[model samples]
Target: MNTYFITGIGTDVGKTVVAAIVTEAMQADYWKPVQAGELQHTDTHSVEELISNSKSVMHEHSYALRTPMSPHAAAAIDGVHIDLEMIEEPETENHLVIEGAGGLLVPLNEQETILDLIKNNYKVIVVSRHYLGSINHTLLTLSELRSRGLEVSGIIFNGKAHPTTEHIIKKMGHVEEIGRIDEEAVIDKQVIKKYAEMFKPRLEAL
Candidate 1:
């Protein structure tokens, strides 16, 4: 089973939403290693609620901090430390969807960032939402993944379309454009399922 690690150029780039689509598309198990805050309503919960597939299982997080901040700061406030070695991946015979917090360079601890959580075997999917200066952010993200020798399966654009922005990023990054999640009035299970079906073909191709 292949693992898909969903990351983003920066925070609030709709990583969780894109993750839900991929999870539903592949009927894959879902896991978010470290949750900084909103313990009652975490990324794991969001995906679970959004997906309609019975095959998908929600895995527990490695660490759940009390504060809503970067993992390192949240860990410090909670009097804990994030050991990358201790952040183990859950076993699954089917594909697994792993979602990261914030961006690639966000710190999980002083010595490590979210980038460290990604294993070499996992196929990376970068989620990008258009915004001013997003071009630079997206390019840098792709560059870092390439430099690390990680397998970047492709990208999933989220929200309203920006032709020029998407065009430039696609041209420069040279990554697969897996699919896009158009602006949704309400992203319910139906919406997620619709995107799931649309993305399934490309995801399987990967």
Candidate 2:
């Protein structure tokens, strides 16, 4: 089965939203190895709801940490360990879309980052916002993936704050802005559908 690991340049950059859109487009199962900052109103379940028929499986430390902090620090405060092996391979027939807890280099353990857990198993998709400094973050993320010999399917520009962000990304070469979400609120089915449709050709090319 084809597998993809969805990561972002930083937190709150819409990784989950991008993952949901991709899952809808590809009809893939979704997995979140470690989820933090689950409030009473917003959680991973909400993300799963957006992707039609996409099965979601969480790790043992899924709900253990509640703070909106980095996984390593959140786990540390909760006295729990974020074990990479705890994230089991799912049994679904669809492709697996694993969403990382935070950014590329966020620590899963003291010595290991989330990138380490996902590098060899899945093609990476770096999600970035279209705000200031996005170019630097996206380039750095792309460089890191290349340095590790990891295949990057493409970059998704979430929350396009500028008019020329997509053009800039495409000009860089080897990276396509597969999708963009312009809404300033929680993404809904229509939004997901819009992006899924926009991403179809790009996804097929991948």
Give the number of the best model, judged by lDDT: 1
Residue 170 miss distance in model 2 (angstroms): 3.3
Best by TM-score: 1
CA RMSD of each candidate after superposition: 0.7, 2.6
Q: Residue by residue across 74-160, what tens digits does model 1's lDDT show?
A: 999999999998999998798999999999999998889999988899889999999888999999999999899887899989989
> Residue by residue across 1-206, what tens digits does model 2's lDDT show?
67878889887788888888877777777777677677553435666667654354432324347777888898888888887677566667777777887778988779888788675767678888876788788887888887888888888877745657667766773686666677657578777877888886787677
Work out the TM-score per prediction. 0.98, 0.86
What 10-residue stretch in candidate 2 is worst by lDDT? 54-63
Model 1 sits at a Cα RMSD from the real structure of 0.7
lDDT of 2 at 6: 88
**TM-score quality measure for candidate 2:** 0.86
